[model samples]
Target chain A: MNRTRFLDSSRLTSALFWLSLVGIVTGLYAAFIYAPNEKTMGVVYRIFYFHVPSAWVAFLSFLVVFVGGIMYLRTRERRWDTLALSSAEIGVVFCAIALITGSIWGKPAWGTWWTWEPRLTTTLVLWLIYAAYLMLRRMIEEESQRARVAAVFGIVGFVDVPIVFMSIRWWRTVHPIVFTIDEIRIAPSMLAALLIALVAFTLFYLYLLIQRISLENVGHELEALKQRVA
Target chain B: MDGVKKALWIVWKDVVCELRTKETLSSMFVFALLAIVIFNFAFQLRGDERVGLIAPGVLWVAFTFAGVLGLNRSFIKEKDHGCLEGLMLCPVDRSAIYAGKALGNLAFMLLMEAIALPMFAVFFNLPVLMPSLLLVILLGTVGFAGVGTLFSAISVNTKAREVMLPILFFPVLIPIVIAAVKSTAQIFDGVSFDQSMPWINLMLAFDVIFLVVSFLSFEYVVEG
Candidate 1:
């Protein structure tokens, strides 16, 4: 059983490893080579393929955290808490990636590295919310209590996300519209590239989530072993 | 509902205690005053030209920070005296406890504002005593206090809670702060009430959404 335990985990890890490598290669080819350059923004617009996909998966991670939090509250399941924490940690990473990529895309397209545009501001807030979620988990010492508090926070924080998005959108509309994403009509190739990148990044997010949750489980086991020895 | 009565009882208890000690209110008022003074120096609105331009931002910043100071004390006061356990031991509904605490926090914030607003108006030379501005303050404070109470309860349980509350509080507060600031700015610019209607509605929506969310989720936070 002990020997098989290591083998079992590694088997899934290896499978995900190969799957991600293939998906990433295909995604890059589709985004850069197969997709046509925009008439206006030139090659700089290709960054959207990566930026938007990362943001999509990052948002997806928050949804997972939201659901996991609700489930933990309802059932008091440790697995749910574990999943929430793992996804939130990864969500922060992907959120950072999205923000950085968006900034990189912005420099060439908008002639500025940052703007208080609605989508950008909303994403920044989302990043902050999850970052604080991770901090809340660290500050609490007791296991069950930590899970409980973080779960409550996770659920409550998710509620504000949509409101933040809408309010920012309304704010921009009320004020002068600064930078609009509506102008670029997605050609067939661009649409195909977006789909490919989104699928690839989502699969990658799942791979990372599985690895993170496993690491968390191992940390739990190590702590338990240390307690037993003490 | 008994829950409503129980909740008000909690608020009454807090108010009575605050009235006697005056610790939270005094600190919040002083902190708010200091914040406004700092803003006055920081902005250095050379003359009449820039005073109105940035008065709303300064007012909201001072109020929000001072409100944070009050919120930090709200739950810590309960924890310091070990009153939280006693309250938890009660058979009353948890939502009642949440509503009650939220109301108590809101009252503290409003009281701070009641004093701070006139002072702010005098200091910044803005006409903040108007009815529309008060209404905006009321909606903004409700949303701020609603979410602030829950986070304060959560933060008080952690180390570095004084720091924790703001870290957790500020992000969730973006919409309210933005809406309030925008609405107040428009009102100050002499825009008609109809012109600022959307920002007012934004604040109202945020208040309702957060109030309901906090009310429903407070039980989970306090119990855990």
Candidate 2:
């Protein structure tokens, strides 16, 4: 908004860009070389490093959208709507990645490319909800109304995720439960590698979210300018 | 006016309109019947022992598809007739409009199911109209109309219009589909009523949650 804040934001973006790059490179090494092969599953278990973080970041981004939706409705701020839209797009991407990686892992681990496991079903439902959010955005022609309706959906869809998980879990769940309250149930090296990947993926998600929000702001300004000229 | 009174008035108006035109019920009923007929053909349901295995799923699928038709008409008619503005202008709470539309949709869905289920039973020779099944149907339809009414309002205003309703409605309605189908199967399996209680509870919970969320966020949807 002001000169110094603008400068600080630019500096922050570049710093995030470089940090994510470095973190991802380090994460790759950690996942591949630092972590020992899993005894039962061997190399197929390597996908877990990326799968867990993508899933985590996907859920994290939806939380951003959910919070943004509430704030947008309360404040009626353009920034909040922009934040929701941007996060939803990123969330969809990461959610898809999580699904694909998990499916690939399922083939080797379970001898099936897909299963109605609780976690898998929840992710798929979340993915469909995200798609609906984006589709809702695309279908509305009016800017403010679009934002309003989308925010409504964002809030409602995020709230439905737990209900979806619970209903499906009650139906069935054979997905491996790796983490518990007390310990993660893995070797220390594997845990360390997972931590690195999680941090790296999280940083990468932040960088993308900031970039997308700024891009949306620019698009809004351009639309305003075009209307004025016309 | 009070919300309930106002909502009932809206429902009264919609039901009268539906009664006069017979438009919404006809489309929904026809679609539902056709779905059952098709299901009968696909699954070969004549005196089959395994009908219980797949019948619940088939019944739910048919009903939900038909319910979407009923929901799509719930708001599209008001908006298309330019009556939505008048409804918005009324001093009543916008949630009155939501509750009214949702109630209207539920009525149409239930009526359609009442006929469709008996026809399905006769054609397939399955005993589907029991008391427990009726309760399951009521719970499922309430959740469908509750959430579907909000989506109906939102979707009818979108670029794709009525086509968007099912895309948005069905995915979020997964819990209802699962719980409803499972409960129906449980009933058919002659399981104890207590065993099916969780599934019934699930539909009841989804009904409450979606209805509250739809009520809270509804004003934003109708406001200009």
Candidate 3:
């Protein structure tokens, strides 16, 4: 019965995965073909579809990690630790995508590959902070000790992220205005395309999170079985 | 209240140990001094002409790197003598150990900063000994040490203790460093205190947030 239930869930996941694949293809088509080009940035502006959605999903992933951290601390459940670790790893990847896409968009838009603009700067710092989180997890050998310490870190690190954003925002204001994304008005079709991309990327993040968590569980079981045989 | 007093005792214990050994303080001070010297040569600044430009960056970089050295010692010393487990065994609130260690780390960082200030002034040929600059230094160090102490405890149990401290330290320290560097640069530029109030306020916010969060979370890090 348990095996049958597990297979049922696996079937659901596979169906959801296929649904997301379809959503992503549609999102791409809408982004590239449906959305009209801007007068200023031209065709290259299509990267915004990928850029903004990736950043949104990345932030969402970190939020999950933060909640998982708190849950782990409160309940001492190993499952929460698995969720936090997996989400953080995925978060780092999406954050890197946000950064790379932002840089690519910046190159033609601002004529520089990188700028110390507030959002980009904060995102880069966010990337570094979570990267450090993963590295900290790697350094600890004991399972429970690693979970507890990493939880504390995730909680404290999340609190600091807002302060970091604010400070960088203020710092940027004191300097000259390099370029402003605010000036670009989102046309209706562009907004539609952005919404499609957001939905698709969010589904993609959920799919990845589910897959990673199950893989971790399998790995945990394998470790246990190996120890039992030994 | 008992927790507060116990925490104070933790601070006193560290102070006495540090005074007798002076090892951590001396190393931190020397390391910071060397960094300042390196900065002086690295920038190749002539006189006070470029001192304002480079002084803040140089000062903060020195302080943070040196601050990590002191923070690492805060917990490692306890771990070395097995005092850490003993402290945990005590009936007192676990956070007292955190408070004590953070306060101790804060004091060492401030002392290093105090001594380094004169050297910084001497090397850059700038009068950076103002009361305002000291305020910025204190706020920045408190935030840095507050978070650093917690992470140091967490890092000490890790394999790569030395590398782990800075890796964990620098990223979370971005706000404090930014606020400190910006305000310190303004002070060196001879900007009045009021001009740097915004940055100072930001530092104050960072300090309070990290202090509360670290104090609350320290138990988990240390107990684990």
Structure candidate 1, residue pairs in collision: none
Question: Which scores better on TM-score, 2 or 3?
Answer: 3
Q: How well is each residue in B1-224 modelled by candidate 1, as lDDT tens digits? A: 98898999899999999999999999999998998788778877543747888888888998999999999999998999789989999999888899899999999999999999988877767787789999999999999999999999999989889999999999999999889988898889998999888888888888888888888888878884
User: lDDT by residue for model 1 over A1-230, one digit each (tens)?
Assistant: 24212222677777887888888899899988999989988888998988898899889999999998998888887888888998999999989999999999889887899988888889999999999999998898988888988988888789889888988887788677666667788999888888888888887887888888778778878998999999
Best by DockQ: 3
Which candidate ranks first by TM-score, i.e. highest? 3
**DockQ rank order:** 3, 2, 1
Docking class of 2: high
Of the true interface contacts, each candidate retains a share of: 0.74, 0.77, 0.89
Clashing pairs in 3: none
Please provide the root mean square deviation of candidate 2 (C-alpha atoms, Å). 2.5
lDDT of 2 by residue, A154-175 (tens): 9989888988998988777334
- Which sequence of candidate numbers ranks them by lDDT, best first? 3, 1, 2
Alpha-carbon error at A31 in model 3, in Å? 0.9
For all the predictions, what are the DockQ values? 0.74, 0.80, 0.85
Clashing residue pairs for model 2: none
